[model samples]
Target: MKQWPFYCEQECEQYNVSSIYAPYLFDTSLLFFKAVSTALDLYGGNMSFYDIVTNGTLIAQCSVGELTGATDIKCCRHQMFVYNKTPVMGRTHDCYYNIGKKEMAYIRQLRMIDHENVNKLVGFCMDGPVLLSLWRYCSRGCLIEILTNDNLNINIDGFFIYSLIKDTVEGLYAIHRSPIEIHGNLSSKNCLVDERWQVKLSDYGFPFLKAYEQPKSSSEQLWTAPELLREPEAHPTKASDIYSLSIVMADLVNKNLSFENSDYNGGADEIIYLLKSKTSRLIRPVLEPVIEDFNIGFTHLIKDMWAEEPEQRPKIDVVRKIVKEMNVGKSKNLMDHMYSLLEDYAASLEQDIQGRTKELVEEKKKADILLSRLLPKAIAEKLKSGQQIQPEHFDLVTIFFSDVVSFTVLASKCSALQVINLMNGLYTIFDSVIDEHDVYKVETIGDAYLCVSGLPERNGNMHVKEIALMSLELLKKIPDFRIDHLPNEKIRIRIGMHTGSCVAGVVGLTMPRYCLFGDTVNTASRMESNGKPSHIHMSADANKLLTEKVGGFVTKSRGEVIIKGKGVMETYWLLGKQGEALLNVDE
Candidate 1:
């Protein structure tokens, strides 16, 4: 036997255990254990060793560990541990190594046993006296843990339970049909649950290894066939496996350990004695009352599986067919059931999300309307879309300024409430007229109203036309706006407009205002202050724009008047449309 340098006596002395032996590495060509990198003391004083080895044709590494722990899963003499290996790039075939003449025979046979309900054997480690077999890791642990756990809270229906039985039967059938021929040791503890909740059979075809393990107790021999119990040296046959499956099925249906509900007064020792003596009647787990409510045919089938005569037991293939028949109209497969549950949950979540989305849209609509009232529609839309409203420069725009002719005199004639009522009525009329044009109302200070056109959206020279038409309409409507307290007293307003470049943008955070900046706004205000009652005053620029660009309006020059800002500036009095009079009195 050839040994690797990793097993040198000097390095092996580091662990303080016995030096590496010679026969442990016999058959140099069949050697699987290369080197031990780390060791873990698993439950029950079992040792788990890790090593890196070549996988397939690639340069990748694999983890090989021994199964040692009290809680570790056991199937006969073979203890199982997790075997994870990363495939090397460009590798076509899987990597493998021989353990020994006896173990390699079982390994070769196990390699041919490929089924969804069977755990795959990746590799094995036989370094020194340690014998470790590597199998795929089942994340959900063993079926014994699931059946015994009280806090797991697994919600299983009758059909779902039957599905598990059917999977077990199928797994057994695969083993029986393979070269392995029969599972010498079949029990609930050997059944593992994968991440998909599918049951897989583990720990089979290793009788040589089982010889080194501890002998099974009478309690653990509950699944052993009557003939096997009588002859302790006899190997498990197909009939004994069938009898064992019946006990496992009973555990599934009863949700308890095998023979837990037996009527025998004595313990498992007494029960084993009776079965072996052949003097007492054959004893099995008593079927619970709930089993009667389940398929009566299923209960009868279980009885046939554990029949006193080994020849009377059904074959693995027949058991699978019977279980399939029992699942005709039962629940779907485990994966399908899980997907159905998730789909239903997702549908309910989608409905809740849609309801919340509808409420959000309605609230957003209300907020949009409120914002539009404070700022221009375009600017409000930009703000809602998370865009910064940069101040815009308009080369040509029309600004309109208006106020009551004598708001103080009108207020002095009425009480404060009457004055408020009058102002509300008057502005309401003007606001309606303002809406008839494209001009946006900028602000309202007491009796003064400010508006602008050609921004935040531009309409070129059309701003002059829009503002001029709106001013004429306002002048035409003011006489009809009588105070509620003094109905007989007619009201009049002074209106002014100017056309020039100005900067407009939203200002402030609390209550933002769409403010207009530049001398054009001030000149427009001056025109409104220096105007006559029931008249529309216009700056020279506005008058020129109204005459040349928008010709439908009638305007007469007010001549050069001494303005506060300028020495003498020419202005105009805006009349009305082409043929209409400036004052349209409602008699």
Candidate 2:
């Protein structure tokens, strides 16, 4: 057998006997040799030397001495006993006799030892020829024992499995987030189950002391990450720990030990070989099949953690978050019988979502139609989409208000049917002009038409341009009008435009209508009431956004004009028809 060296391989010529190791003055003395002997014995033959030192300190009062080998050592489990004494000691402790108390104190001060996840050191005391320390006990045994137990059977339900995975992840999260990385030995034995079957991570450290002496070449490379296994260049990292954890998860899912169901008596080489090759598939068959049978969302998550490239694994924090999302204890049975029920539930949910989406679309269409009829399609869309349709306050917006100028006179001369036909013909042309330039026709009062731009919704600089287009188009179509079954007659319409901001919103819940109220709206109405037939009166602010984009009308400032609600506003008159230029210019 190959010899493993200590952490510091330098040899010491002088051996120091621990003060705690002394012959008991008498068998009846509280500080007896027998108690010290038993404490040291329990630690001597242990799988982990670190566990020995710590556990010895807790159960027995003694100082620890270095152990070269078990031979010539008499500290056996049968000899250990607790003695009520001022001093304690061990006999036949030939390895080291007088280890200084100060050195043990120094070891306690190391930051790695102080970590909560690390095995805690209670205190060090002395007994005759023995040294002792304390540690937390795990009854279910180390991960090694659990994994090596061939007869071990675990039939944990799926929900319990989920919870265990989550708990393990949280434990790992704490370790990985600490200043130092804690690489858990990936085996079934280290994960100890308490009374309630809740898993508690035991063997709480990497045992740096043992690892230093353990040859890197001889270490089990199968549990290691690919990068670490392939070369000596890569040092251990948190991601490496994650890789080990994924393997543990695989074993739990399979309900088998992590050794690929090999016989328990196999040597380390045989176990390592099986683990690296065949055992690697344990996690796959267990995790993949289970998720495929239950929920497929997390199957990819399991695969990602076992990725050959360490960097591809999700960070510990992300893993915690993913595990937290899983619903544990939500399901009872783990058989294939629930498959049909789950499928039916999923189908029902999908159908519900589809129905809701369809209903929303139909509502949107109906709302859009109503909005288009009330305001223009363009303004309606802006409002429906919850865009900022600012009430421009005192800011000037061009308001275009128009009507059939000869409506009353025509009605008095013609029959009722003839009058109705004539009105429809004129309003249809007005509607076309409004649609063409994206202008909102506010409302009509008995053949009186009202439209505006840059008021309820700010058209910015384009307000006047739109009004100019609508005005020119309406004027052009007026002269060609002929009412069916009625004598041909020439009629002119007046349109007024003003630029200012006005308050606008949905009014009256009973018949919710988007209405504009403020000086801007009133002044706009006044412009049309005061304007002449075939003319478009616009405010100065309305012209700014136009930037002469339309060439049909000759525009000139009408100077300050007294208007209702607006004491006086600078207005403009759009004088008719540069037909070819107007048709060519894009609004």
User: What value of lDDT does candidate 2 attain over all alpha carbons?
Assistant: 0.57
RMSD of each: 15.9, 26.1
Error of 1 at 415 (Å): 18
| Consecutive 10-residue window with the lowest summed lDDT within model 2 | 16-25
Work out how many backbone clashes candidate 1 has: 4
lDDT of 2 at 417: 78
lDDT at position 348, candidate 1: 83
lDDT of 2 by residue, 26-49 (tens): 222233234445555755565355
Q: What tens digits encode model 1's per-residue C-alpha lDDT throughout 1-587?
A: 22443454444432222222322333222234322222121211453232223222211122243543322233223332322443111101122334578767777888778999987766655652445556665656667776777765344556556767888888888888888788887899878777687998876666665544566788878788889888857688899999989988888888788878887778898888887887756688887734333665777889999998999999988888888887677556888876776687678879999999999999999998898888888888887788987888899999999988777887889887887887788888878988888989898999999999898888879999999899877776777766656767887788888999999888887787889999999999999988888888899999898898779888888888888886689998877788775643221
